[model samples]
Structures are given as C-alpha cells and as structure tokens.
Target: MKKLIYCVLLISNVLLFNSCTDDKPIFIADLGSEKIAFTNNFASEYLLSKDTKNNIADRFIWNASILGVNSNYEVQAAIDEAFTKPVSIGVSKQTNITVLVSQLLELVDQLGLDEDPKTTDSTGKPNNSGVVYFRVKSKIGNGGAGTQEIISTTHMINIKLIEKVPTSTTCNPLWIVGDAIKNVGWNFSKTTVCDSDVQRVKVSLQNGKFRFFTAENNWATGLNFEYYKGKGYTIDARFKSEGAGDNNFDFIGTPGIYELVVDTSKKTIVLNPSGSFWAVGDATPGGWNFTGGETAIVETSPDIWQATFKFSAGVFRFFKTQGQWDINNNYAYYKNAGYTIDTKLENDGSGDANFKFVGTPGTYTVKINAIDKTIKLN
Candidate 1:
C-alpha cells in the first residue's frame, strides 16, 4: 500500500509541472508610424471654409499622433514665419483620417511657378513655399494610446507668382453673357402664353406662318406672320390701329424661305388649298390665304386664322410684321385702298389670350380651322 501511494504522488507532481510550463503571458509592443499627408494648392482652399474660425476641431485632428489640428491651416499661409516655432496647422486625435487640398490650391499648384517660395518678396511677405508638418501623442486609457508615439511630416508645395493685368474696357461677346444665362427662365416653347410672365421673350421657327393677336388689343383680326423657307418670306402683323401702323416685320426663322400672310376676310379664309379655314384673329401660318378687293367685305373676329405654305425642313421665326390702317379704325387696309371690317372671334373655352407664335418646324401637316362662325361689324 505504501509503494502504490508513492507512485500516484509522483504522477501528480509531473502533471502539475507540465501545465505550468505550457502556460505563459504574452507581451507585444506596438510602435507603428502614422502619417497625415496634405498639399498646399488651390484645391486646398475648401479647407478654409470647412475650418472657418478654427472653432471646429473635428476637421483638423485625424489621428491620435496628430491631435488638435483644425482646418485653420489656410490662415497659416498669412502668418509671419518670424513666429517662435513651427505652429500647428491642423491636428486630430482619431486613429485614421484623410485630408484633401483645396481646389484652388490644386489649380495653382499645377502651374509650376505662379507663386513665390519661402523668402519674403519685394512686398516683405513671407514666402508660402514650405510645407507644414504635424504630430500627435495619445493619452493613457485612450483607444489610440498605442499610436501616440508616431510622428508624421509633410511639406507644402512651392508655386510661382504671376502678375495680374487690368481687364480691358472692351467687352467680350462670350464673357458678356456669362455662364448664368445659358438656360434660365421658362422655356417658351413648352409653356402656354398665359403661364408666361410678362416681358418674357420666346423663340419659335416656322417655314412661313401667322398667329393672332390677343383680346387685350380688342381681339383684332390682324395677326403675326413670318416667311423664310424659300428665297425669302414676308411678314404681316396687324395691331390695334392706335398701337402701331403696319411696320415691316422681321422673320425669326431662317431668313430666306418663309413668309407671313394676313387674311382680312370677314368669312372663313382657308389657310391651305384644302377645305379648312383658320378662325378669324387666330394666326395659323403654314397654311393658305385668299384675296379681298376694295369693295369685297370680309368679316372680322377675335379668333385665330390659319394658312399653309409648302416649306422644306428648317428653323424659322415670325419675328416681325407690317400693315396699314387708320388710328381710329382697328381694321388693317391693304396698302392701296380698302375699308376696315371686324370678325367676331372669341377664345376657345380657355379664358386666356395672347399673341405669340413660337413653334418648331416638323414634317407633320397642321390644319387650322375656324370656330364660332359669327362675323363682327367694325
């Protein structure tokens, strides 16, 4: 019994020794370096707006090794190098952060020598060529405590300085309009006249076409027309006799092949050789026309008219029109001799009226027929 007890005690002591030898605590020393890279270029200017007044510390300090840096690095450029030691531009205590240069800096940086170097220039300003460096040490118990020992250094780029010349008094066509006017205001073609604001100019093109005047002018039968799709076209725009006499109108489309036709017929005037007629006062060009002699009486109304003219595909504008009439009479008289008449045309159910023709030239045939056939007595 004594010999068996001795054997069991020996085995237990061996097992305890083996366990103690296999278990050991591990110690690892982390001494890794951290870097915060940046460039002093035009693109870097955004950092100034981002770090305004240096009150926001989050933008500057990226890692524990470079803590306390803010976006105020831009103001550092104006600082006098005579100051005691290198000042901190930006610092962050975060483990990892990425910094970008201002767009302006990036632009100027690309131009090799538009800016000066470290030495003061004739104006006695410090040269901005030198790059700024940063470092950060982590505090105990902080998650980034291990990175505190690392230090990062980088330099600002040197750029050449260029002289500014006074702008010329002469105006440049391209610069006069600038980028703002490229696509502003409502697109006239897509919007109705009632929806458009006053004084808005819209552009449209037709080979040769005519449109009506609005009720604001007593709904005169005289309308706006243009022609420029052929050798050249003519425009005939009639207005209230008191407004303006028939003045030679300009065409908005290609200046060569279209023409505007004004039909003073009191009855329905077919705009196309086909049987359709345009509503009096309703300007429907790209249609047809009929003639009225001195004694021939045609009715007048405040409706739109139509006429069709053969045209090749092209952009055109009914820019201007011309007519002759007495101030007291709203009816337009042919240049020779004629009396004014009225056509009683009203607005199509929609309570809106305006005299503006803006359209694009397409191959599709347009038919302009009249509505409410009553004739007006002037």
Candidate 2:
C-alpha cells in the first residue's frame, strides 16, 4: 500500500512539471512604429566662442518611447547632413541635455571652421560660419542579437564662430542709437552722428537697448552690427541682421558718465564707466570696470607705460585681459608706491592691495615701470 501511494505522487509531480514547461509562450521584442523626435524650440543660429568655453551653447530636448523596452538617447552633431560618421555630442537616459561651448568647439573643428573672417568657401560665404546638422539616436536592448536602433530626422542650425576680437587692428567706428543715450536716439531722425571716424562717444546713458550702426539709422545698408552679451555663452557677437527684438545690446551698467567705444571690426561694444584704462578701480575714470580692457597708460618707452587720467581718491589695479579678473597687477605688485601721493601699497592680495590716490583728487600722470616694479605719480 505504501509503494502504491509514492508512485501516484511521483506521477502527479511529473505531469505538473511538463504542463508548466510546454504551455509557456516565447516572447519576442517587437520594434514596429516606435520612434524618437525632438520636442523643443531650436535657435535659428548658434554662436560659438573660445572665451565662453565653460558656458552652455544650446539645450536639446526630445521625446522617445518603446513600450516595455528601455531606451538610451544620444545627441549627435555633424557637418554633413547625412550623418555618415556623426560625432556624439552627449548621451543620457533623460529627455534633455545642455551642450557646452567646448563640445561645440569640437564640432567646429570637424566642420573645418576657419577663425579668419576673410576666409570664404566655394559658395563665396565666410568660412567662419556654416550649417550644422543635429539629431537624436535612440537604441534599445543590449548590443547583442536583439539590439534595436532608431535615428530621428536631422535638423539644421546655422553655426557661427564669434569673432571675439578683431584679427587686424584696423579701427572702424560705429554710431550709437538707443533710448538710453541722450542726443542721438533710436528715432531715425536723430539716430546717428553721421561721422564714420567718430568711433568713441562719451555720453550719459540710461537703461535701454542700443546698437552699433555703420550707416546712420539704416540697419539694412552696409554693416549695422549689433552687440549681444551672449545668452548661454560668453560671446561678444553681432546680431543676425534682423532689425527687431533681440537685435540690440541691452545696457546693464552704472547709470553714470560712460565712454561707448564700439569696435565694429571685433563686433564688441565697451561702455567704459567714466573712461577706459589699463588699470581701473573705484579711483579711475573707468571705475571698477576692472576687466574692461581699459588700458591706463601708453608705452612711452619699451618697459614703461604711463598716462594721465583724472583719478579720484580710491584704489585701482591692472588686468591682463578684459572681462577677466584672474591675472592682474595690483598695488603690492608695484613694490614702490613710495613716491606716489599715498606713498604706500596695501599689503593685501590682488583683491584689496591696490594703489590709492589720497589727499587732493585731480588729474594726475601715472607712470609704471615694469622692470623696476615701481609706480610714480605727478
């Protein structure tokens, strides 16, 4: 009776195991009408510059799905419309990503971009600008047998290499036109000064939008360069020739006397608060616009740079580059502020240690000797 019961239980277990194994269905990954597409506003043009390498050039966002499959999205850019060998800008599991100036620079190289504005392509357009094609590539599953891939339709955007500074030192002056300035305002009647040689203008400016024009009041004629402070990057660039909306330099500075110096060649506009100099601080005319490329002195001789400016009673320092505070010459660097009005150099770092013009505040000649590391004032 015991052997009979054990045989019946074993037969039942075997029958159950066979039914479970044979009745199951084999599932396959179906990759039919699934697709990926961009779902964000794209800029009509992208401006790139070496100065703003740390800034975000553009933001790419897309929507993708593949039902039960996990999808990985990659943002890619190429000079060719048909991405023969696309360079991957970035990859993510999310739906969006920001491309940095450094990444765009890499694409610029692959596109054979020329920094020189004079260099032109076969179509007679400048090589400094070109069209860049971008797309999102989505993939599912592992890279084994059942790996699936889908590429979104390509999108093109005009890419321009911003001319941070002009290649040549040739000076091309521009006219000032904005509600901010007093005399020559945005109205076409009183728009410009009409003198091409008048590049720099000292005037009182309020909060408004301004642009540099080669021809008086007319934006379409020859070269009516507009200043852009760079949206996501540090690009001192001109506008896209469109005369509306974002085609003006939004003024953001101390509402005082300013010297509006426009470098039409470089597409840069510098509003020197007071005046520009190699060294500027609370004391100098270009008050604390420290990195605004305002050279204080002229190289009268080889190692000597001296010039005269109406300095107030405040400390000032020198900067190597405009709009950058890294490398500079401070009061402590002078070593000898002994003969100057203050007769002392602040014992602080680059931040506070500067030469202050004490006592009577008036126009004074400042002489700096780079070799001796000494400063003389008169």
Question: Pick by TM-score: which candidate is best?
Answer: 2
Tens-place lDDT per residue, model 2, 9-69, is 9999999999989987988767656778887666667788887776556567888665445
Q: Give the residue spans of candidate 2 off by over 4 A.
A: 1-21, 24-29, 141-145, 164-378
Count residue pairs with overlapping backbones in model 1. 88
Q: Which candidate should be chosen as best, given lDDT against the real structure?
A: 2
Q: For residue 204, what is the lDDT in candidate 1?
A: 28
RMSD of 2: 17.1
Stretches > 4 Å off in candidate 1:
1-23, 33-84, 95-148, 153-378
Question: Candidate 2, residue 243: CA error in Å?
Answer: 27
Error of 2 at 353 (Å): 31
Q: Write one digit per residue (lDDT tens) for candidate 1, span 1-378.
A: 999999999999999999999899875443343344432222221222222222211123333333422222221221223323433333343343333334324333433223333446456664333333333323331245332333334334233233322344442111011111123211111211221111111222223222333332232432332211121332223211122343213323342211112222221212211111222222333321222211111112112233334222221111111121111111111111242212222222221121222333322232221234322221
